[model samples]
Target chain A: MDLAILGAGAVGRSVADLADDYGHRVVALADSTHAAVAEEGIEADAALGRKEAGDPLGSHEPEAVFDAPYDALVEATPTTLGDAEPGFSHVERALADDRHVVLANKGPVAERYDELRELEAASAGSVRFEATVGGAIPVLSTIEDCTPESVTAVRGVLNGTANFILTRMAAEGLDYDHVLAEAQDLGVAEADPTFDVDGTDAALKFVILANVLGGGGFSLADATVDGIQDVPGSALELASEDGRTIRLIGEATREGVRVGPRLVPENGALAVTGTRNIVQIETREAGSLHNSGRGAGGPETATAVLADVGRLD
Target chain B: MDLAILGAGAVGRSVADLADDYGHRVVALADSTHAAVAEEGIEADAALGRKEAGDPLGSHEPEAVFDAPYDALVEATPTTLGDAEPGFSHVERALADDRHVVLANKGPVAERYDELRELEAASAGSVRFEATVGGAIPVLSTIEDCTPESVTAVRGVLNGTANFILTRMAAEGLDYDHVLAEAQDLGVAEADPTFDVDGTDAALKFVILANVLGGGGFSLADATVDGIQDVPGSALELASEDGRTIRLIGEATREGVRVGPRLVPENGALAVTGTRNIVQIETREAGSLHNSGRGAGGPETATAVLADVGRLD
Candidate 1:
């Protein structure tokens, strides 16, 4: 498959390095500021070298990637919440050109699901966003195999940043602030961590799951969100004494989507530690299914993007 | 789609009840002694009634199902090792007739994977065996979505009967015989439980998983098998003190397939209790993926069969 990657971040670079192993060719590469396009495959090694040396990838504008002949567009741009601009426009343009899309960007899928479906209906291509929810866990594709109507509910620990903080606080008996500082030092938490710490990231993932499971027309505004910022060390100690752990769980059901910190049996499937994520699905016929794995990382998320590319019909 | 069912057991009856909901028309059903065929679709409720009343389901011979016109064949017969007869011949005949096969019987898949693949290559239809391994867990389909080449290894708790016995022994501080008797009384184990207690059941499932993940040409003869029959209660108590639990794990790697009792952290992903099953897959780029669900029961296995039927092109 010929590919055009629409971002130059860690995930985009990882995809470039691994695409060859999956029998894919990178024909275009673009960042917000520059773009590189080739009729044949792009010079992936040179482009990666320039980016690593702190040089601009290319001189062409981002829109120039569309002019290249490619079978699919890999949208790996960083996500932005409301209207999901830039990323949304990139997806619409690609779909309109009869090109399939594999997305690592959460903004377009979670925030503009219904509109994207409209574009898919009008275009010759389709879109897949497995990386938007649970990095390489295959959560969305699992749901696809079972079909949405058979599923009753989906619950999971969707955000690794919040999970890391809570796991540390519970295991080390540290307060939230101390643990947040430690996480930031370890690069597990960002300098501005509101999106993860305040539960917005999990909510966005929950909304995306709901859409994939045939519960479309929902967005972050529809979710009842909560975070783990106010959890006390005393509560963690008490829960530990009782052989339980607290995890920030995001759930989607027919009623609505919700995100909050909940108590789970310490030995149960949902009580994963560190930066791991778990998704538990309830179906009327197949009973309950649980999937867990690394929820965030450059190579892990890019692997999901590659898997989606392989899924294209 | 038109279907031909070749069993009158619990799984077959369950499939009959659920097939309509999946948009399938059952054109034939057969037991060891009798068979039923309807061109338009069988009367599932009536056929089930006759079977429940100890009456023959129909006047036709068991071989009569092959003559019926059908698009796919559902092989739900009991499994036999060694030559894997009757079941093996049944599957061969179906594939030879250019019909797809969905198997609940493990004999053809675990024992004759290479032969079955040859038949599939020469046939116009495909073969799906989701019900042969992890019941309703979708283990095979999950590997299909990720592609077997990218997978490094697959590890899982693939049997319910042995898992139930081990879980009971650990929780109640009872010995193996006592728990085995309890499980038998509760209908969780067969009166003659050698296949499950001796790990043959898990070994069969491991062989099937290995074949589905592209590690074909393997069978029970190639596996290093061990059962939980000799597990002592004192060991469980000691392990509990150290916050660990023992689970009967079946693993399939490029080297070989093996089943044995292994220690897992009590709070880890593999430490599932009761009759539940879990499969963990390791990949080169995607990290580790874990899937868990109900791995047994008539309705659950039938649900997996129905899901496979829905997946047919």
Candidate 2:
């Protein structure tokens, strides 16, 4: 398969690196200000080298990628809310041009799910966004493989940064500020860290999952969001004494979506520690399915994009 | 889709009950000695009632199911070792006739994977056995969705019977014998709990998973197996002191497959209690992916079969 990748960030480079092993060819590569296109295949090493050295691979505009002869377009751009511009327009153009899309960006799917679905319905190619939710956990594909309309509810520890802070506080008996500082220093938490600690990240992923499970017309605005910032060390100690642990869990049901710090049995499936993410999907016939893995990271998220690329066939 | 179901056991009945909801027509239904056939669609309720009343659904022979018109055949017979007979021949005949096959039985998959693959290769249709391992967890489908050669190892707590016994022993501070009796009384274990308690069941599942991950030519004999029958309560107590729990874990690598009791951190993903099953797949790019759910039970296994049937399209 020939491909064009938008957003030359960590995830895009990772996908370009691993695409060969998965028997895919990159025909176009684009970043914010640079673009490279080749009829045969883009030289991945040269493009990555130029980007690393703060140079452009070519002088073409980003929109020129849509003209490349490629089967799919991989959108790995950083997410933005509201209009979700550039990312949303990129996906719209790709789908309108009859090209498949594999998305690592959460903005387009979480904010414009119904519109995207309508575009897919009018196009010859489909859109897949496994990387938008649980990284490489195959959460969306698992739902696709099961009986449609079987999923009743989805609940999980969806944010690694928040989970890392909460886990550290519980394990080390430290205050939230201490753990947040440690996590930021270790690059587990972002410099701003507001989206993760304030529960917007988890809420965004949950809204995306809610759309995937056919909970149509759900967005971040529909969810009851609460972060872990107010959680104190004393609460963790009290919960530990009761054989429980606190996790920032996001749950999506037919009725609505919710994100909050909930108590899970210390040894239960939902009480994962460190930077791991776990999603428990409740189905009527298949019972409950739990999937856990690296919730974020360039290579991990890229693997999901490539997996979606492979499924385009 | 039209389906022909073998084995009028619990799984078969459950499949029959749920087939309509999945938009499938059961054209034929067969037990060990009786079979029913209808071109339009079999009446699931009447066939089940007849079987319950100790009467055959029809006068057709078991082999007569193959002659009936159907798109797929569901094999849910009891598993047998060595030849993996009846089930093996049932799958072979279906694939040879160019029909899709969905297996809920482990005998054919674990014992004769290579031959079944060859048959599928030669046939117009395909074979799917998601029901053979991990019940409704979508283990095989998840592997298929990722890079085929990226899987490094697979480790899991695969048996519900042994896990139930182990969990009871640890929680109640009781010995294995006491818990074994309790499980048997609750129908969690069969009258002859040799297969599960002796580790044969878990080993079979691991062998099947190994084949699915492209580690073919493996059978129950290839696995290094050990049962949990002799686990002492003192061992549980000692492990608990270190915040660990004992689980019957089965692992498959390129090297080989093994099943035995191993210590896992009490709060880890693999330390699931009661009858839950968890499989962790280690990959090169995706890192580690963990899936957990019910590994057995008529409805759960039937749900897997139905899911595979949906995939036949």
Candidate 3:
């Protein structure tokens, strides 16, 4: 299999490394500055070295990279759903050439799920974004494999950094500010964690899933957006005293969409704490499937992208 | 799609109901006693009536049901492994007839995975059993999606009843006898819970997974099996005091298989309390996908069967 990754960030490099290790020809790797085209598989270690060295991407060029001959595209660019000039141009180019997409970035789907659906349908069932929601959770494929018609709801913690912070606050009586600072220091939280802290990241994910479940376009604005920013310290303490924990729960029901911080039973699956992001999907046939793991991070998201590509190819 | 549900047990009846609701014609439903053939589609509500009226099978004769035409066969009899018995016979007949199979019983695979694999291969890619473990958890399907290569290891709490008893004993500081009696009375444990408490049930599940992951055959004896029966009360208490829980974990590795009781951190994904079952699969590409959900009981298992039939059809 010939693969091209349209980003040199953590997720993109991880996918390249795994694919190259498994003997797949990683033909191209790209970043905002430039892109590298290699018919004889890109060296993942070298790509990492280039990033660490902070060398200008003079030897690489984006136009040639996008024009490279590859069977699939692993899109791991930084999320651009909330912005205009996102990575969709590169993805659109790849899809137009009939290259199947395994996406971790929430840009294309969250911004335009319906248009992408049309593109996928036109291409004969080739595009998948299993990594957009739960890292390596498999919730997307599970819902797709089960009853497609009766998926009445998708709910649970969809953001890892926020959930990790909330878990710390709820369990150890730590302030949210302290936990957020620690998470950023550890690289779990981005320097500007607005999307995750304000629930926009989860809303983007919910939009993608709601489209898949309903087979129709859903606007992020239609969701009842709330975030962990306003969850009171007293509420967390009360929940802890009651043997429960507060998790930033995102849910979509027939009644409508609901996202925010909420109290869950201490022993519930969502309380599988730490950096794990757990999700609970309620379907008509499969009542509820809960998945938990390293819900966020470069390695986990990259693994999901590789799985999606491997499954399709 | 036409569905032929063999065995009117909890799972089969549930599948028939769901398929019929989805406009798939359930042409046949059979039991050990008799069979029901309805070409136009059986009324699920009426079927339930007959089942509850001491005729749990609903006025169906076995011969007539088997003779009916159908597109897919859902074999969901009670699990009795390693025997050329009813479940295997049903699957064999389905395979011989060139019908797709969505199996929910372990007997067919446990007794004859190779023979069944050959039969399926002969007929082409038409048979699947995603509902075999972690009811509605999608562990098998996720692993299949994760990689085309063989899986390296699969470990989890496969048997919900054993885990439930162990969890209850640990939480309530009760003896084995007390917990067993409570579990049986609550209908979580079988009246004769040998298959669950003796590790035989988990071993059977691991054998099936090993076959899928390794493309080879294995027996129950090949697994290093242990159960929660010997968990000393003091040990569980000590683990609990240290914020951990005792779980009966079954693991399949390249070296061998291990099924025994182990201590997991209280907040660990596998430490999911109550009836929830969690599975961790280590694969070549996707490092680990942790699946957790309700693993036992009638509704969860029935939903699993429905999910399998829904996908296969």
Writing each residue's lDDT as its tens digit, candidate 1 over A1-313 gives 9999999888898888888888899999998888888878888889888877888787688889999898899999999998998999999999999999999999998899999999999999999999898898878877876678788899989999999999999888899999999999999999999999999999999999888776588888889999999989998888889989899999998678999999998777788889999999998877899989999998889888888998788
Best by DockQ: 2
lDDT of 3: 0.76
A1-313 per-residue lDDT for model 2 (tens digits): 9999999888998988889988999999999988899989999899889889888866789888999999999999899887788899999999899999999999988888899899999999899999998888978877876654888888999999999999999999999999999999999998999999999999999998888777468878888999999999999999999999999999987777899999998878888889999999898887899999999988899889988987785
For model 1 the local lDDT of residue A32 reads 86
Give the clashing residue pairs of candidate 2, or none. Answer: none
DockQ-based CAPRI category assigned to the predicted complex of candidate 1: medium
Question: For candidate 1, lDDT tens digit of each residue in B52-171?
Answer: 899989878989999899988999999999888899999999999999999999998999999989999999989999899888887887677667887878998998888898888888
lDDT tens per residue, model 3, B159-209: 888988888888889989899999999988989998899888888788778
The regions of model 1 sitting more than 4 angstroms off are none
TM-score of chain A of each: 0.98, 0.98, 0.93
DockQ of structure 2: 0.73
Best by TM-score: 2
User: DockQ: which is higher, 1 or 2?
Assistant: 2
Predicted candidate 2: what Cα RMSD to the true structure? 1.7
TM-scores, each model vs. reference: 0.95, 0.96, 0.86
Model 1 clash pairs are: none
The 10-residue segment with the lowest total lDDT in model 1 chain A: A141-150
